[model samples]
Target: MKLVKHWIEKIFATITEGIVGALDVFFSSLQKWFGVGSMPYIFVLPNLLIFGVFILFPMLLNFVYAFTGGTDFFPNRRPWVGTANFTRLFECQNFLVPNSCSEDLFWRAVFNTAGYVVAQVTVMVAMSLITALILNRSIKGQAFFRSVFFYPVMLSPIVVALIWKWILQENGLLNAIILSLGFDKMPFLVDANWARFWVVIISVWALMGFYTLILLAGLQSIPADLYEAAKIDGANAWQSFSKITLPLLMPTMLVVLVLSLIRAVQVFDIVFAFTGGGPGTATLYMVQYIYNNGFASPTKQYGLSASSSLVMAGALIVLTMIQLYVRREDV
Candidate 1:
């Protein structure tokens, strides 16, 4: 024990010395070139440059493109149209009634996305919470079950979608079973409502494990003594869960909710692979519409696509802001 402690101490001391030497050399060079007061800015300059290059520059270009009409990819060739794209997008007799808009498909995408997020997030969070609670209990094959649930999380989204697509196709395994039961083959992806339903279900199934793992982490962190004390006071499972679990789990729940909503809003690959935004655009979510407009459209309305992207970006910003507020409040 004494030898192990001595080795650990020596290791930490060496690390500390190395950090101190590096910092000293760095500051000396900075002081020689500039001054101590400029150290903070100098240190942040590289990160700022990287951020500007990778994030800020792309965002600025997207924003600029939103104001320019274009079939051409080059900004130099794209004609400046000011806010004409926005004006066209917003030209509606009534904002609430999406059909009144010039870009009715865009508005339909927005509405579909909103509904999808609400339903998907609600089911996803609830199922994850339930799964986490069940998993938190002592059980045989617990680790095995956890691995099984989380296996889907490791698979690529497209792969998952394709696998599900095969199962849900007209002449797939599911229909094979249905036929064996003397029932008709179902058009799971061909029908609009069915496509939307399957999209949400598949999304939840693919993602449940990730959120379950998160909730499980939160569940495990709660001191066992709290549950013990509650038990001594004759608290039943419902009482214990509602009072102890929910309250303590609130922060994690909020995080899961926000993340689920963001992911739900941004859902694309699965819907694309599984349904292809078909059955008369019933399952067309905003991101899919953005892709269709930005790339697949006959004219390829880049400005309109950029404008749609900005709307999605705005939703993302609001979600991020909400997350920040919730975390701060929790703190």
Candidate 2:
């Protein structure tokens, strides 16, 4: 075993050294032929090409599609009707009442999605921070607890949603338990309010571990001496945490915030797997709405879908800007 390990390490080191040597030679050749200034661009060209091909090309295509309306698969053949799609998207008699809007389902999706973000992010952050704080303490079986909690994060989103679906169904484990306790079975997935509630709860349950890991990393990075100094000054746990921990953890929290917000906006798989936006579109969100319009609906309004996508992108960009400004101000 030792002899095999020795040979394996030697071979791995040899391969790594060879790769480094080749890169050095490649960069040197680039500098010789293309000038030192062009070397960075030369090295970055592959990634730039990839980004252009995949992300930028698709984004530009989507933007262009937003300006054209039709059921035609060929984009060029589709007639241009500039701003009409967006105009229809925002055509609302009463924005507050989704039923009064021209695109009622779209407005309903927007409203539901907004509510989901507020509830899910709030719960996710709070749970993650609290769990991370607890786990960061000198507790026995810390690794075991951490792994147990993080286990859910490793599960596929579809799998997580399906598991929760079984648990929350009418004749499922949870209702069975409730019946055994002589309590009325909950309409977890049937009622609008309950469906929305469970959607947020399940999302939080599936996602908490990842955000916990982030906050844990932030917690571990905090200087221990700050807590000690606070202790010496007769400051209690709450004071130290509020004054030192929360402030220092703000940057990581901001990262968590922005990422969680993006995930919340893009939430579709779990909701789709569990509810299919059912109980009269209770759990229908932006991405699901986009999917319905673009592909699932019989008419397949690609233009409307593309326009909605652009609107969502614009909202996300604005949100990111606001978070960045807040981060800078906090710093």
Candidate 3:
């Protein structure tokens, strides 16, 4: 028995030593290939080139252009005027009459953009999570229901916007339905407030399905054993959800929130299609303002528009960093 025990101990020590030696060699080889002395640039060259051409160059050009006062894209004879574009942006009066007491349209657009982001992000995240939770449960024809929920996401945003535009028009189907139901017609896209509200609603409707599908995948990844164990401990459904589900599902929730916030900040298409920043600039978003100034009608202010775009991009980066910090703390 002593001889057998000595042999067993020797075998275990040999295996452990072999594993440690093998791991050390593997790490050493990896360090040689990826360490400070290695040519890491060779591996990252393609990505660097792509980012430089697509992102960095454009960003540098925008920063330079923002300090100029060029109305034309080519800027035939325009000269640089440091901070003049920004000052003009702040000092410009309203295009509309009577309310033209030198209010900054750019700042107003920023406020409108902020409000829209807050409203849309809140609605989209909440609605998507609720829909995902509902679909995660066992139900009849779940596949069909899932398909129905995700169908909107598959459609192009422009197509969705056009459909919603007709539906929310003055004499549109929504009003017709209301009239049929013996109620007065609601001005969904006519009045400024109604137009803004409808934009948020339509945005939520269009995006909820996509986010729900993503959240559903997260839900499906959670272990059923955790819920079963909770149930065995005499926990109710709500208790199981709060204890086993939310904590585990938090990472997925954070991802969805970050993505939703970024998308909301950069939203443009739906605003363009639904309400062309009309009803006296009630629904004018930052992107739409940038588009109008940089490319669209009336007075072309490409330099100022570039400045606004830079500001918006900087704000998004800050917000994203804050969100990541909060998520890290929670984790």
Best by lDDT: 2
Query: Can you give the TM-score per candidate against the true fold?
Result: 0.84, 0.86, 0.79
Q: What is the lDDT of residue 280 in candidate 2?
A: 93
Clashing pairs in 3: none
**1-331 in candidate 1: lDDT tens per residue?**
9999999999999999999998898778888899778888988999999999999998999988899996888888999999988898888898888889999998889888998999899999999999998898999999999988888988888998999988988889999999999999988988888888888999999999999999999999999999999999999999998999999999999999998988899999888887888888888899999899888878888899998899899999999898888778566
lDDT for position 171 in model 3: 93
Task: Say which candidate scores most in TM-score.
Answer: 2
What shift in Å separates residue 70 of candidate 3 from its native position after superposition? 3.2
- TM-score-better candidate, 1 vs 3: 1
Error of 2 at 251 (Å): 2.6
Pitting candidate 1 against candidate 2, the one with the higher TM-score is 2
| Least well predicted 10-residue stretch by lDDT in candidate 2 | 322-331
In terms of lDDT, model 1 sits at 0.91
lDDT ranking, high to low: 2, 1, 3
How much lDDT does each candidate structure score?
A: 0.91, 0.91, 0.83
